[model samples]
Target chain A: MNYRGPGRVRAEEKPMPEILHPEDCIVKVLRSCICGSDLHLYNGNVPDTRVGSTFGHEFVGEVVELGSEVNKLKLGDKVLVPFNIACGKCSFCRQGLYGNCHESNPEATAVGGIFGYSHTAGGYDGGQAEYVRVPYANFGPTVIPEGMDLDDAVMLTDVVPTGYQAAEMGGIQPGDTVVIFGAGPIGIMAAKCSWLFGAGRVIVIDHNEFRLEFVKNYAKCESYNFKSIEDPVQFIKQTTDWLGADVCIDAVGAEAAGSAMQTITGRKTLMQAGSATALFWAINAVKKGGIVSIVGVYGPTGNLVPIGNVLNKGITIRANQASVKRLLPKLIDHVQKGTIKPKALITHRMPLRNVSDAYRIFSDKLDNCIKPILIPPTVKE
Target chain B: MEKIAKGIPDIKDWGIDADPENDPTYPMKPNRTDEEQNGYTWERSVQQAETVEILKSTERPNLSAVFGTSVPPKGLSGAIRRYAYKNSEGQFSHWLPLLIADRVNVVEGIIDDLKKGKVPNIYAEKGFNAMWKYNRKAAIGMIAANVAAVSALGLFLFRGRIFNEGKSVKKALQNYNM
Candidate 1:
């Protein structure tokens, strides 16, 4: 699926990518996912998104062709490719901050190269195709363990790791109350993962009725529609004995819909790159000196935020693209033990050809779409 | 900050999670003994033997630890790209010809494919089918522009004959009917 500006995606056949570097390998895409971050490009909130670019980052594929230097992976090995395209030799990657690799995306300083995230992210085409040329193949791609469902394997690429990182960054102390903003997949997963970090209670905030209900059952956490509540920040404080939650997470970024001001002036880019309604809420909703961990995708530029409140409240802000390469082994163990049901999160599984319709359904939130997994045409049913 | 809270606060909820036995996440805490979290042992991949000619940037002191073996510099477009690597990447001289060379390489690839008896599907692969199906207005406009260009070229190529035929007809009319 190629991005045709905002709110439009088209499936088109193209030339097969060749080995661009010795570290690169051509992976036949078995499964790719439509990530929440993809919606930023779909809505044209992300800058430097070219018209012809493909927009998928979470994928698992079979290594059909290998470059000469890739020694860890062999031809025909199935691997779960992380969204972060990090070269392991980089200083950041050496320090386990693989998301901020220096060598992979030499042009940027913050987050490193990402697949199909547009030119700002090293201009690499995404895995939402028949085949994708994966650079730095030796570092990030982990061979999928035996009997692991492809759906579960693909979620491990981005959503699970991001959700895990959000909770991990919060520094959640034992018996601390955690409030997560947004009931999207990442938000819901974050709520679930918080329990692993000893969260006393978890609360998810969102305006979508279906998503709220889904998270209630799925994450087994309290869920509320922000529209129905008087105010989300006030509600969080009220529920937490007027002290606010210990840790607040902003899982909703850029396109948060609660505030009209944020939508028009921020997410619409009238005044900022994207909306910070959720970030604003998270900041104001947390207890003094509480952590605000953000894993939601945002533009590389600035946003209208209440920095004064952060100073006064003494909040600790932790945000970054998740370092998937750093957290995969433990997550795999969790999946193997059935401690986390990653596959249960997938609500829609559609072929890559129907990506246009799938994008519409997901964008419009039609048919209770939680997360859609896109299967390439070559995969057997 | 109240002098760092004077060691411990006297608040009602103070000193929570201070004991390991009472900590809810005690079982969930990081186990340093776990082999996975411990200092992991990894090996650097053996350097790939460079059997093909590789291009290195002028800015770098040496070639990368690894370079691509596929599509080594060979044809005319490759020569242009090879020249591009001789200059600094910041220069337009290095990048502009690269953009031109990419399109030039496509034509070279098509010719090579023809030599191998592989008919390349330029139309379908170029997204014409997608454009016509999704955005018909742009497709129709592109078709019209192509047609006009071809007609103009045909007229220009046979302009002498067309003008000569018109002049002969006028001269014949002057002699016959007057």
Candidate 2:
């Protein structure tokens, strides 16, 4: 699928990619997912999202060809390529910070390369089609172990690692009450992961009734519909002995819909990059000296955040892109052990040609869609 | 070394990583599997004698220990990339033009492929074969949706000419009076 602009994508035929670098390899995609972050590009929130660019960041494929310097993997190796394209030799990669690799997306500071994202993320075409060219193959693609489900493997590429990192950043302690500010796939997974770190209770907050219901059952946690409540922060404080919850997570990012002021200023007017409604709630809902972990995607531009309250509360904030390469070993073990079922989150699976309709269904939240996977044409059955 | 630990017990976790094979990063970072641990085993690789034009990073003081035989900077996109390398990779001027150059390089590759008498199979490679074999339901739905869209567009565009007694939409509505 090719992006024409915001709210517009079409299926088109283009030349197949070749190895342009010594560390590159061509992959025949088996499964690809439309990530929540991809919606940022679909809505034209990301800058330099060129008209002809493809958008997908979660994929697992079979390596069909290799570059001259690629000896770690050979032909016919099934692998899950991490979204971040780190060059392994960079200072950040040396420190296991693959998301901050200096050589990949040196387009600017901070963010590293991401496949199927805008030029801000190294401008590499995504694996929404039959094939994709993976750079830094030695550092990015991990061979999928035998007997693993393809659906679960694709989730490991982005969703599993990202949600795991969000919970890990919270530093959840035993008997700590955690409140998550979204019920999306990542938030739902984060809720499930918090239990592994010894959280006493987890409550997911969302305006959508279906998502709240889904998270309650899937993550086996408490759920709250923000629309029915008067104020979310007040509710959290009331439930947690009037001191606010121990940890709060923001998974909604800049497109949060709880505040009219944030919607207008951050989203509608484009005055700021995106709405900080989720950030506002998270900062005000946590206990004093508590932690707030954020894994949501936001624009580079600043938004109206309540920094004063954050300073006064002495809150420690941790946010960054997920480093899948660093967390793959542990996550794979969890999956094989039947502890974390990533494939259970998938609600829809459609062919690659139905991408436009699939995007509409997911973007509109139609038919209680939780996650959508796109099957490339190259795969047989 | 034991004099300092004369009064203390050795723990299992303290020196567990003494074995070089216990390193965690080498598994994921395949490019660094042969790297010198702690800079104690450092050694330069044998240089390639191939005289291919190489485009090394400006940040590097000299050529690398080994380089690949990639095509040199020659085409229009290649020229732009060479100029882009003059600036730091972190500069936007360096990356924006490089992105545009990638698209240009695609067109150049297509032209080169055509010159070699190779043509891409649009119908097969574009997934029509899969539609016939595995996704007939989706293919039919797509066809029906496209037909409905075209029919609706045709009726709206030729509304003035198709109607006999009432040509315009307003006149047609008048004919079917309430």
Candidate 3:
């Protein structure tokens, strides 16, 4: 699929990949996902989201061919690849900080390599096609464990780890009230994981009624439509008896919808990098000396934020790309133990050829689509 | 390494001839044309009457067998090296493990290229570049930090002479005494 322009995508036939390096292997893609981050590119929100580039960061595949130097796998190994393309021996990878890998994305300094995101993230073609060249196959691809559901493994690639990390960064204490801003898949996952971190109360805020209801049922947390509430911050303060929640999470990111001024300045006019309405709310709604964890992504440029409030309130803000490789082992255990239901988020699955239709449904929020997966035509159900 | 193809003759003269009149390190002067000097003498290059037989050794040269496992420092020295690796985010610290891993990848990449009858440049294949060239902003920041640090150190060391200049040691002492 080629990203022709904003709101335009078309499928084009491309040649098969050959061995570029000894560590490279070709994987026949079985499953790929259209992530919320991809919307940033599809909607022309991210810079340098080049035309004619495939966009997908979450995928699972079968290793069909291996380069001469690939030692970890044989032919026919079904693997789950992390979204981040990190060389295992880099300093960041050695420190379990694979998201900031040095060698994989030598083209830029800001971000490590990410598959199919954009040029700012190494410019590697993603797994949205029938086949993709898996660089550093030995290090990146993990064999799907026996009897593990493929859907669960695919979510483990990005959504589960990111959500888990959001909660982990919040450092939720026992009896602490946590407010998650967003009812998207990651936000829902964060709300669910907040319970594991000993949060006494979990409240998810979003404007979408469908997603709000979905999170309430799936995450088993309190959900509220921000549009319905007179003032979200004031409501939260009143509910907590004027003492704000202990932790606030911003899972909404740059493409947030809320305040009129923010929408005008951020989304419509392109004055700010992205709509930071959720981040502003999180900063205002958190208790003094509380934590504000941000897994939401912002553009490369600066954005309007409440820095003074954060400093005065003594808020410890922690943000980072989820180190998927580092979290995979523990998350796999969670999936096996039935502690997390990652596949429940998958509301739509379409063939890779119908990707345009899939994107439209997901982007428009039609039919209450929370998550969408793309199945390559080569793979049978 | 895999042996060269069977049909290809091994050249006897791998090293250039030395000029006795000049320094031993310097090779003989090249006067012949490019084609004449390095002509492809496929058949005659392999001398048939050589008495020295090539030996196929049974045992492989193992570094571990020759010199046991690496000797890790057990005292303060080891702690200091570990601390340096842990605290520093410089290129040296970042490149150490990558050097080890890329060494094998680079070699295999070269070997594969050779098998396919292509000359491989390891530097390009490995995507290796100096830190300064790779990240100029970081390099400039490091250079600026070093300059500031050195200037501060110089000021600290020469503080008395620099700040208390124009006051003679004897005259100043006498004034203080009076």
Candidate 4:
């Protein structure tokens, strides 16, 4: 399937991307996952990738080729591509923050520009193609642990790591109240992280009843429908003794409407997905002397923050693109120990040729699908 | 000295001698005949020897000749005496009068000189003090007139109603011996 325009996909043939750098490794797609962000671009919500950009970010694949200088892995290694591209030795990566490496993209941050995005991430084509060239493969690509299904490992590229980062950055301490805004896939994943992180109570808010119900049932978190509730902050406060939640996650990113609920008590933390607007509200909603961690995607233009307010409140803000490499090992351990079931989040699966339909179904929220997996045509059972 | 020179008139003799008590019959001086009052009374009274001495030593014509045929002098003393007193009269009634009027002309000239340019070195060092005396009198007169008009208006309009009430109140209290 080919991405032509917003909600416009057609079948087309194109030359496969080849290894252009010594650190490059070409991966043959085994399975790829559809992200909510991809849906935003697919539905023309994001302006850059509207016309014929390959559209998939979350993926697991096997290496088919490597450049001359590549020595980390041989061909036929199953790996998950990081959502952000990073060179391991840079200052950011040396500090275990690979999302902003210096060399990943000299023009941009080390945050992986997936297979199908625009020029912001070095204009390196994304992984939605049959064959994709991975830059800085030695530092960026992660090997899928043995016996793990490509479908489940695909989420490690984006969703699992992003959700986990949201929870981690949100400061979900033991017995602390965590309020997650938006019941989208990332929001649910954040709620799941809160539960795993031992939050005393995990509350999820969304305007979509179906997604809210999914969060309530699957994530086992308290769900609030913004549409049904007259006042979400008051309602959540009533349960939490009029003191707002200790941590709030704005996983819905730019799509989150209006201002976030103001946190009156405790050390409030806001975990932003990919929205500068969410970061703005998160900055406002946080309590004085609180912390805000922005894991969302920031374009070249920096987000406008009320610097005076942040300074007056002594509010600390930390932001980086999602660093899957740092969180993947723990997530993989959770999966192996059976503490977390990554596959339970998937609601749709289709073949690679039927990718256009998958985009439509997921992008439009048809059938209330959360994470949809696309099995490559060449992959065998 | 010199026997007090009773008939010799000096600079002090150059003035009008109008004595109201001496001429109390009409309260005015009666007009006298040209011969009696010719030249001046003081000139006719001077001694002949002094008149002749003054006339012979002088370079100009005799005072009798300068006075012409209007009134003949009684003698040589009369001529010199008439010359001295007539000179004093001339100083006050004609040229001296013009000199007084010329004081204003000199003041205007000084103002013109100040307006035209800076005071010349010669005038500032020599003439400035004498010129300023007359200028000062004129300036004071102009200033006093302006001040008097302004004060009169102010006292008439402002003090008449307001200050007069205060004055009347004090007067009433004084009448009550308080």
Give the top-scoring candidate (DockQ): 2
With a 3 Å backbone cut-off (N, CA, C), the pairs that clash in candidate 3 are none
Give the TM-score, chain B only, in order for the candidates: 0.62, 0.48, 0.26, 0.22
Expressed as tens digits, the lDDT of each residue in B1-178 for candidate 3 is 0121122222121111112232111011122124323332212111112122111111112110001011121233333333333322233332233223222333443454489796743222121223244445654775688699999999999989977774677679889999
Identify the runs in model 3 with alpha carbons over 4 angstroms from their true place: B1-178
Q: Is the docking of candidate 4 incorrect, acceptable, medium or high quality?
A: incorrect
TM per candidate: 0.72, 0.72, 0.68, 0.61
Give the per-residue Cα lDDT of candidate 4 at A165.
Answer: 75
Ranking by DockQ: 2, 1, 3, 4
Model 3 chain A lowest lDDT segment of ten:
A101-110
Please provide, for model 2 over A34-75, each residue's C-alpha lDDT reduced to its tens digit, 9 standing for 90 to 100: 988888777767654555678888999999999888989999
Model 4 bad stretches (over 4 Å): A43-50, A109-112, A257-287, A296-314, B1-178
Error of 3 at A353 (Å): 0.9
* DockQ (Cα-based) for each candidate: 0.04, 0.05, 0.01, 0.00
Error of 4 at A196 (Å): 3.0
lDDT of 4 at A147: 88
Model 1 DockQ vs. reference: 0.04
- Model 1 spans with C-alpha error above 4 angstroms: B1-178
Ranking by lDDT: 1, 2, 3, 4
